[model samples]
Target: MSRNQQIWLGELIRCWKALAPADDNTRKTLAGLVGFAWQPPVDQREPEATPAPEPELPPPVAPSAAPPQPMTQKPKEPPPNPQASELPRVAIEEEAQLQAAEWDSVEVLNPPQPHNRQYNNLLPPLFRPLWSRTIVTTLASRRLPIGFVDAERLVSTMAAARPVERIPRQPRWTTMKGVQLLLDKTPGMAPFLSDQAALAALFDDCVGGEALERLHFFDSPLRGVVIGGKKAAYRPPQPGVPVVAVTDLGLGAPESHFNRAAPGEWLSLVQLLAARDSTLTILLPWPAAAADPGLQRCTAIVEWDRSTSATLVRRLLERICG
Candidate 1:
């Protein structure tokens, strides 16, 4: 190559070396220009090789110096499965087709709503017909008839002055006392919300709103209860008024419940109900087995269920009243 050509080529190669990526063509071109030999950088020429890990040596075993023995025959591998080709193959994936629902098979019923007249009540069928009369029988007080004429009083008035103390007339159990419903609004009584509503309706129907009263309490009334939306001591209606109290008597409470009523606490309440001028009847949700024995003796406990018939309530009330 000419001297000028060599100089230009040398300059171009140096420029390429500084700016361009590594290429064999540049080295070749530079070699032809002035016998230029390309020498790679020291780092590219020799690289530090990572040592391969040595294979774990077998545990030291004593070498046996036995004489050479005849070679044993090698066991052949098992033949390929003959039935593999004959097996039925299933599709790897199938395109699923959605079918229309068989809505005709199902009967869609538009049931009568709760507010509808066709709606059947949870109250016992036999109860509504018999409870008003049955309760009257249970709670009626023995008093002389209003228009009763006393012969002794008439004779006393005819003979002496002022009728010598009004003649005592034979008492008749005919007067129907008013009623009050004491409802337990505690956690234990939550399940009986519907039952309470049914009972309230039943009582309200039996005795008009004027005669029917509702009171609220927690687990027990020993600590008092809610009266007129304010905390007040729980007392039944006035003398001759019957009170029907719906309570679980702490039987529904958990074992570790803090407000669970003790047998003595229940006894005190029962004594108050049965002994006081206000008569109380418990509509217990639990079975008779868990009932307090003292409570059983004090007042009539009627299980609030389909099993509790009018006859059963009448018998239970008669047992307490008689």
Candidate 2:
């Protein structure tokens, strides 16, 4: 309590106060050292805070509140063509040209070969002509039967194959005339005539000189010749041309007048045998049972025109060469 002591005490208290937060002992020392009274803080003061209440919300709306909707839009379509579409002209023309360029021109041939024959038989069996089955032969064993059969079948089938002049009644004496009239009068006859000539030329060409000599002819010098004896006569108006005639069915004689006889019947048997003449006579009709017809009685007088036969042979040769 002296003045010095009090001053010392004041200094110590000041030091203690400075160091008070270091320890509890430092606080007690600071209290003892200080002459004046002082107290340490004991309790912490609480901080004040306030929060506001939330406001009430309205209920959610139903699907009915949404706006009415339209269907989804479709993509736009292209406009329709006013005119119908067609193939291009170039394409059409090209197609037509292709068809024309590829066309085939095959032609048929007749009197088919035996082994390599195109047709099955001489005549179509189901529907056949009367002459298809007929056969004949001359007195010298020359086969007129084959020739007549071929010629008649050729003529008949040709008539049937195409539109031809049809006579209501075909007479025996008038066949060649009928044929001539048809050739002269038919419409579109050019193609048919040309075709026929070409066919005949083909046959002629196939026959060699030796083969031509094989054909049978009756040698005669006259405007025409008689065939089938005294019953019938076929005269080719031109010299050296051949004619055809059939025997009269009613003629009862074994050598019917129509079956044999002719003008200029003086040719040698060899010449007649050679078949070089143009006129040819053949017998056709099967002899009746009571009367048997033989070829020895059948004869022909064929007229000859050297120029015509040569021409026929030459044409035949040309065809054969092809």
Candidate 3:
């Protein structure tokens, strides 16, 4: 198509002719036609350079003084080719570095805090109040850290002789004397029953050595029942133990109470107290008659009769200990 392409093609034809098994004359003719000139047999042929044509001159310069014309020259060429594919290598590296820096500079937003939750709406409003009323307000009312057991002495004695501290007697429900003894012996019974030592310390100031000496369990000889806060006990009293206090402590009582309510109001106040308070002993009204279900609502029932002040104290104690 172009002059260079035609020349290259002619050179290729000359080469092909030399390699062919044609006659020497034919090969010589082909070389001449392709513009390949041969030298004498004794000497090798040398390539000759063709002189370029002179550039055209400008018109005659004026006589007046003027600046000289600048020389016209070809532009400087780049260095020899490396490879086209390698051109983007540097750009790729720079782009990756920029992305990493941008990611590092970005800051993360904090998550939102959760909202406070309330009781289910299906439950009656009375359930919450009853539950709150039953929970223990003092450590003296619980079973753990008995008022009778001296922690320091107990720990020391246990370390000296045995590997574990000896369990001390914790007074539970029994006869009227047992109830009086529990009240008289440990005025801080509500606070002392908690497992937390810090909470028990609150009642430690109220309970004395005298109350500690007389502390005893009902029926069972075992000392000090561990009660409340994660680990707790809901032991039903034995046949011999008298009903000093009554409570709807069993699950069956609450289930029955739940059945009595209307279809929409399924929860029982007594059950709500047991679930939430974990301390108050809920007293259910005795059955109205022989065939009545009220009597079955509670395992034990005790009649409380005292002066206004005494009644208040008894109620307070019941709230704390139950």
What TM-scores do the predictions have? Answer: 0.50, 0.17, 0.17
| lDDT pick, better of 1 and 3 | 1
Candidate 3 lDDT over 63-122, as tens digits, reads 675554323322354563778456867765444333322221222222221322233333
Cα RMSD of all models vs. native, in order, equals 34.7, 52.6, 35.2
| Per-model lDDT | 0.59, 0.30, 0.31
For candidate 2, the 10 contiguous residues with the lowest summed lDDT are: 176-185
lDDT of 1 by residue, 1-322 (tens): 5565456555644754454423446544543344343332212112324665656877776568554442332235357478844755332111100011111222222333333222135644423444534543343332334445666657767677664555545445443555777888877887777667766665665565677778888877777889878999876567666677788988787677787767787667656766655556788888866787877887788776556665677667666766
Q: How many backbone clashes does candidate 2 have?
A: 18
Give the lDDT of residue 252 in candidate 3: 22
Q: Pick the candidate with the highest lDDT.
A: 1
* 1 versus 2: better TM-score goes to: 1
Instruction: Give per-residue lDDT, candidate 1, residue 103.
Output: 16
- For model 2, the superposed segments whose C-alpha errors exceed 4 Å read 1-235, 252-276, 288-322
